[model samples]
Structures are given as C-alpha cells and as structure tokens.
Target: MYNSDTTSWQEVLAAFKRIWGYDDFRPPQGEIIRSLLEKHDALIVMPTGGGKSICFQLPALLQNGLTLVISPLVALMENQVQELRDRKLPAALLHSELPTWERKKNLQNLEKLRLLYLSPETLLSAPVWEKLCQPQLEINGLILDEAHCLVQWGETFRPAYRRLGAVRPALLKSKPAGTKIAIAAFTATADPKARATIQKVLQLQKPAAFQISPYRQNLHLKVQTIWTPRGRRQGMLKFIQARPHEAGLVYVRTRRDSEELTELLRQKGYATAAYHAGLSPEERRQIEASWLGGKMPFVVCTCAFGMGINKPDVRWVIHYHSPLLLSEYVQEVGRAGRDGKPAEALTLVSEATGWLNPEDKQRREFFAGKMRSQYQEAQAIASKLPTQGEVATVAKQFRDGAIALSLLHSAGQLEWQSPFHYIRHQSGKSCSFGELNAQQQQFQTQMTQYLTTRECRWQFLLQAFGFAKEAAGWRCGHCDNCN
Candidate 1:
C-alpha cells in the first residue's frame, strides 16, 4: 500500500519528499492525492496535523496548469504561499494585501505558476471573476481549504462560500471543455448536513468524501463546570499557572472576551497575547508568528481565530464560552495535542449559562423570522428593480440579514447581483414549497439536537458527522468529567 516505486502516485510522493523533506505520505494522503490527480471532486475531512496541504500542493506541481486554492484566511494564504516559495515551488498568493501593481504583476506571473492561493473572499469578487473569465486563464484544479466553514462552522451565514457555485460557471466560461478541472474541499470539521451543504453549494458531481475521526487519544479531554465568572477566571488562571511556560490557546465567544482574558492572564504574570478579527492584519500575523515560533506560550483568541493555524505544540486549548455547537467544540479541542504528546482540552462551562439559554433560543427564533422577512424583501425588490443599482441599494439594507437573502435565493425565492451581491426575482415567480420546508426542518433539527443531546460528548460528535467510533481510547483519565 505504501509504494515507493515510480508510479504516478510514487513519483508525486518522491517530488513531495524532495520539496518538503518528507520520506513518506501520511495515511490517506496517497489515496486523496491520487484521486485529485485523476481529476475528481473530493471532500476530505481530516483532523488537524493530518497533512492536508500536501494533498493539493503536490498535485499542483505535477499538473499542467496552475492549481487554485480557495482559502478563508489571509494570514494562512500568505504563510502557505511563502512556505512553498521557500522550497522554490512555483507558488503565489492573491489577496487584498498586495497593491494594485503588485496584484497585476502576480496575475501576470500566473502563466508560470504551479499554485495560486486566494482568500475565498477575494476569489468571490467580480474583478477576480473577470480575470477568471479570460480565455487565456488556465486553472487545472480548485482546492477549497477549511471548507467546512463554508457550511456549518460559519456564523449565522457565510456569504462568501454561498457564491462558490457561480465561481465554477465563471471559470468554465473561459476554459476549454476538455480541460477537466478537479475540485477538492478539505476541512477538519464537518457534520453530515454540512457535507451535504458543501456539495450543494459547489454543485459537485457525486464527489468522493473521506472523513478521519476527530478523537485524538493523546489529548486529555476535560470539561470543568464553573458557575461564577470569578471562579471561571480563577480556574483558567490556575490552569495556566500550573503549566507555566507551555503553549496553549484560550478560545472565547467574542472579541471583547479575548482581549479581557488575555489582559487578565498577563496581569497574573503569564505570557499572553490577544488575537481576534478586530486586530489589524499585520498585528494578527505578528501575534500568530510569535506563538507559532515559541516566543509566547499563551494566546487568547475568539472562535474566529485558528482557521488555518499549524502550530504543533499547543499544549492546551481552553474554551471560556460554550461553543455554539459541539462540532465547533471538537475542532477547537483538536488544535491541542497535535505533536503526538499529551495535551489538555478544557471547557469551563458556566452553569448559569447552562447548555441552553433564553438568548440562544431567541436568536434562533429571530433568525427564522428574519429569513422569512428577507425572502419577502428580495421578492418585492426583484419585481421592481431591473438595473443592478436599484437591486444593490435594496440588498445593502438587507446585508446584515444576508443569511435570509441567501437561503431565499437558494430556495428560488429571489435572485442577486451575484450569489454574493445584488437582488433579482426568481425566474419562475414561485417557491419550491417542498424544498423550503425540508431545509428549514433540517437546520432546525440540527440546532435542537446540538443543544439537547445527553450522550457522551465524543460519541454524539462522531455520530453527528457520520463517522464511526474506532476502538476505545477516548476516555482520557484526566478529564474532570471522567473522574
């Protein structure tokens, strides 16, 4: 199974070793790599440290045309592009960070590149679409990294990923029919519904799906129920104090919480830094580098952080807030113990907040009500607006409620400038009642189950994602719940 002979897969692995200094492929790497090279759409859900980049990077080198990787993080894109270039691979990143002239130069060099990394936000832009529509632009494959965010892991909505279906059409418009572009979606977390959402959003043609389990035996999974704010803070402080100089991550629910917690940790004489989306791109990059390079052992960040984080020695992952869902909880915990060593996964659930809150209940109810309102708004706007400007004006008012617009648009209740912008009428002027009811029911079911489940957290998690439990190694002896 682990072949070293000169087959196409072996040849690719050999080049991989030569470029990245690795002698063997990780388990499932060989299978996924071969599938990608054969020009097939693949949905891969591997845990952290599972060698996801090589699955697409190696294929990019061996393919005839440039490979396009759609990522969600600017820092991640730049880091990946830089890492490839360090190894002398023909790679570049296309993100807003580059100046106009620099971006033009990068695009000009596209004909010579093997891999081009782009933020999904940038890739969904109209100007980018114009370039992709060019007759000369050649993309052999599309690799969507952290693809689960496109569906489940995203907040109330993910507008950028909602536009991926249109991206394929735009790319296909310029390329030859025989080119055969392969699409690959990779993530560390995705439930069954999320997987289905990805397939529908991308319009993949019966894509092959592979999911490795999230349970890591080496990581001790722990949950501590803390009722008081001061008690939770003290518990976190004590945990960090116990570890001293070890690396760790603290994931809070909001940006403000990340900052406050980081400051508290620092005041208590620990090396800590705050990280969240609110930080400048440069500042975020600096904080990430400091942690990754071992300059700091503790970084308090929001759930928005860690999309593409690759630090292998994160000794602990502590959650200050109850994650919106268990899938998110598992992925956040997976970040620790990546170095094949003992690590800690701790969630300090505030008993007052409990598993379900009135606010959460209201938020879900509000989302449902707003979805209906936005659908009607889109329908009304579509009837009146013929030009793009009128459609855009109305869409802007509803931008904060984009999820409502997106679901309506997907359900054939309205149209938009693109999947990302503008509004238009459904071609049929009618709704698919069956489809609408089904999606609404499905999303609601997931939301309810995630909040109410009483099973072993790990078992519930694996089953939600359609992954089978392996031989038992999940009961870490140190977890508070275990004792």
Candidate 2:
C-alpha cells in the first residue's frame, strides 16, 4: 500500500507538473488531492472548466490500485481515456460503443489497468461487476464524474445511478477484511438539494465537501422574453451577427429545433451545424471535432453538446429556448469564458400569452403534469412489483417501471441488492407522492420567476441554488439587469 506520509506534497506537485504540465494547482485542487491521497471521501462542486478531472486523475496515478471512474457520457469517457493514453498513461475505457476486440482485451487485462473509465450502465453489467468483485482486483477509489447527473437523471433516464449507494457495501463483501475504497463525486452544477441527493444516493460517509462559488465574473448573463417565434429567431440572428467571426453555441430545446435552426441559420448565410443524441456516434464525433478544430463557427445544438468539451475560447452561448431547470441553465452557460476572457450568455424565453406563442408556459405545465403522473404511476405499481427483482426485468414488465422503482428507492421505500436487483423495504408510512409533485411544481415556479424577474440574473441564480449569503448584497454589473 502507498503511504501518504512517505509521499510528500512536493512529490505530488512534481508528478502533477510532469504529467499534466501544470506548474501549480488551482485554488482548491491541491486540497482535494491531498484529501484523496489521505484516503478520505470527497464531494467536489466546481464550475465548468475548473480542473475537476485533474483532481482525481492525478491521485489515481499516485495511488496503488486501479481507480474506477464512473461517468455518464460515452463521449466524455472516450475523451478522458484518449487524453490519458496520449500521455502514455495506463488507461482504458469500456462502453457499449467499443469494438469487440478492444472490449475483450481490456476486460482480460483488468489487473494491469490503473485508471478505468466506464459508464454507470457498464459498471453494473454482470460481466464487469463480476470481474470487479474478485478478491485479487484491488480498487483504491471510485470517482463519480459529473455527479449532478445522479440527481438530474437518476430517477428518470438512468436508473443505474440510483442504485450506486449500495455499490460500496456490495463490493466490500467480496474483498478481504480491512479493504476500504474511497469514493469522491465531482460535478460542475449541483445546488444544495442536489448535493444532498448525491450524498444520500452515494451513501457517502462523512465526506469532505468542497464547493466553489458558481459565479463567473467574465460571463455576462442576459435573458430576452419574446412574444413570437419570429421574434426569437430574429433576436438569435442579431446576437450571432454581432459576433460573426467568433465561436459560440446556440442551444435549442429539441432535436427538431436544432435541425430547423441549423437550416434557418444556413439559409441566412451562417456556418452552423445541428448536434443532438439522435445522430450516429461517428456523426457526433465529426461535428464535435469540427467545432473544436475551429472549422465550424457555431453549433445549433440540444443539451447533449457540451459536457466534456474543453474549448477555452467559447465567446458566447445563446439559449433559443429557456432550460427547464436552473441547474441546467447554469451548466449550459458555464461552458463559456473558460479561458477567463469576457463571454456572453443570452437566453430567450417565450412570453406567456393566452394563445399566441405560449410554448414556454405550456412546456412548463406539461413537465409538471408529467412529473406528477409519474409519481402516481410509481406508487400504483410499487405494490405489484416483486420483493426482489432486476431493474431490467421490472422495466420489461411495465412501462417506465425502472424509473418507478428508482423513485421508490429515492423515497426510502426500496433498497437495491445490486444495480440490477432490488429488495423493497417495508415502512409503517409510505413515501409521500404529493411531496414529489410539490417539489416539481416548486422547481417549475422558480424557473418561471427567473425568466420573468427584473432582478439581477446572477443574484437570482445564486439565491435559487441556496447561495443566498453570497447573493445578498452582490450586484453583477455584467448581467442584463445591472446593465
């Protein structure tokens, strides 16, 4: 085992310089690294482009055993693994997209791997989980990259993340006595409630929490409320035209929107492309490469475009449709000003009218209603579910059954046996379905207020995310309100 006492901070610094070519650690990075090296679990919340990956990557190298990094996006996993490999580090990634031969080779040589990056889905797969549980395979830590996705997508889209709380205990059962693996979660956008959800879902044990203010001084935030689709289009065109030669991103709400906007922009003689999850992997990679290589001036994309991208010169980001939640808005806007140069973020919200262009209000109400229905559906299906069953089995049995089970788990009504299997818990009082609906409505209301408020945009965000102390007396001269 590697001894933290013998490995001094100077040694860590030297390694960081030699590997990452960084002369010094940014603000809280050194502290986080030290905590990990000392075998302490951590919850790190930093803004986008804030060296989060390096914090865990460096320690994984300094540690004795393999570090399993759980990531949500396949592109992100590939990007990190490729970068590590480019540096001649022993790193590999396992995902569904991998070629058969490469996947077979990596699985066969698990012992030689130092850093293993894989999605939550692949991590809990039978073959991979079986290999990881072996007594001989030593795992030093588990890093949850982009941890907010645990709260954002855990219940609805990716049910695997909801079961991660049980992973540590289950893995411990297979290891020899006295084996402890530290877990650290890293995210660019997670508010206080989201942070609590991450801690509870991960079952973090007295973790060392680190949070940097989400405020970016160089980012100029603005919101434009429009009464017509044409007005929104014209507003976006004007914004893009003003920054003609610069690189920026225009975010739309749906894939259809992305395609339509891309076509519209092209017709108006702008160089842009549509990016969303529906495209093939090769198509997505090509578009991403074009954007990063400065070939594409701008991309009209959905929310899938900017998770692991590290373009330092993103001059601005325009949201054609307001994001459903404030956390998502913060993350999308956080993509700008990475190089600390002045950047702009403009969000266009549809005006709430009785009949003409009421899309935004209708969308919010639709989502609120959908959330309520889902909660009711979950409660209705909970009793009929087997006491012990696999997530895939339950999903196959009923529509959105996986999500239902995940909601129950989040409400402390069920316990996961593994990622796939779960055992229902019996409590005197069942979960409050009404509470879930109320929370959904509350989130919708907050977003609505943000769109319509005349207050400082930055202040509103800080307050919404439970940073009221910081928001209290602060006036950002860069935001639309202050300007």
Minimum summed lDDT over a 10-residue window in model 1 is located at 385-394
Candidate 1, residue 77: the lDDT equals 85
Error of 2 at 45 (Å): 0.6
TM-score of each: 0.85, 0.97
Question: Candidate 1: lDDT of 302?
Answer: 79
Pairs in steric clash, model 2: none
- Positional deviation of 162 in candidate 1, in angstroms? 0.9
Q: Global CA lDDT of candidate 2, please? A: 0.88
lDDT of 1: 0.72
Q: Write the per-residue lDDT of candidate 2 for residues 1-483, one digit (tens) a residue.
A: 347867678888999999989899998999999998887989999989999999999988887778999998887887889899999998999999889999889998888888999988899888899999999998889999999889878876788899888889889889989988999999988889989989988989999999988999999999888878799899998998899788899998889999998998899987779999899889988998999999998899988889878899999999998888888889899989899999999999886663778877777777777788888888888879988888888889999898889888877778877667789877865467677667767776787788888888889988877789999988999999999
